[model samples]
Target: MQNLILLLITAGSSSLCACTIQPQAEPVPSRHVSTIVIRQPRGEPGDFIICNDGRVLVFPVAHPKTCS
Candidate 1:
């Protein structure tokens, strides 16, 4: 009876050791690119607006003007 109890205890303890604890890996950082839109001043006249992506956009003149 004592040997049976010891065997049961050893089997239960060995099963608990099967699980391993490991530190979680950190996530890799990612790079994001954003586009910004720029509008010309209400009364100012300009040909184009410079963009962050190295492109110049044509500035459309507002019709009938806009209230400040």
Candidate 2:
């Protein structure tokens, strides 16, 4: 029927309009290493140190003020 053909055409048009294409991004090399130091409160979670080169160091909670 003509109504069935019109319904099919409308569905096809809506499906085509819903399609999208995203541009891909090129990866860039890192230049410098980054360092992060975290010192949580005593008896708390702890501390963590991370480097940009995928290095990680973890230590227990300690107070420098008490020792110095």
Candidate 3:
């Protein structure tokens, strides 16, 4: 009987060990709201966006070698 009780306690405590404790995030302050969406093409990885006012954003154009 005592071994059964100890087994139950061990199982309960081990289950509690699986619980996760996540750190809370700090509050962030923001003023302006802006959004940009970049769509991934079917196969290529060099795609980007140059949208105007959150709409009709065209894909990235060929950049000049020294357009820094």
Candidate 4:
């Protein structure tokens, strides 16, 4: 019982003394991701298509006349 009380006191005292209160950091500025709006030409088949999500998509243009 004495050992338990002594252990508790030692732990409590050490934990209380080991603390360091540091200054709080400043709040970070709100970040705004601005998108650059560019006028993209319409893409033909086998050409690049500028998507609304800022991505380029290209698909093969199959000419049915050439597929004889």
TM of each candidate vs. truth: 0.29, 0.29, 0.29, 0.31
Whole-model lDDT values for every prediction = 0.66, 0.68, 0.60, 0.67
lDDT for each residue of candidate 1 in 1-68, tens digit (9 for 90 to 100): 99999999999887767544445578987688788999766765645566677776665455232222
- lDDT, candidate 3, 1-68, per-residue tens: 99999999999888777554445677888888899998766743344554445544334355422212
lDDT of 2 by residue, 19-64 (tens): 6344557799999899999865666566666756666767665731
TM-score of 1: 0.29
Return the top candidate by lDDT: 2
Ranking by lDDT: 2, 4, 1, 3
lDDT of 4 by residue, 10-57 (tens): 999887776545455789986997899987557654645676677766
The better-scoring model by lDDT among 3 and 4 is: 4
Say what the RMSD of model 1 is: 14.6
After TM-score superposition, the amount by which residue 64's alpha carbon in candidate 2 deviates from its true location, in angstroms, is 84
Candidates 1 and 3 compared by lDDT, better number: 1
Superposition TM-score, candidate 4 onto the true structure: 0.31
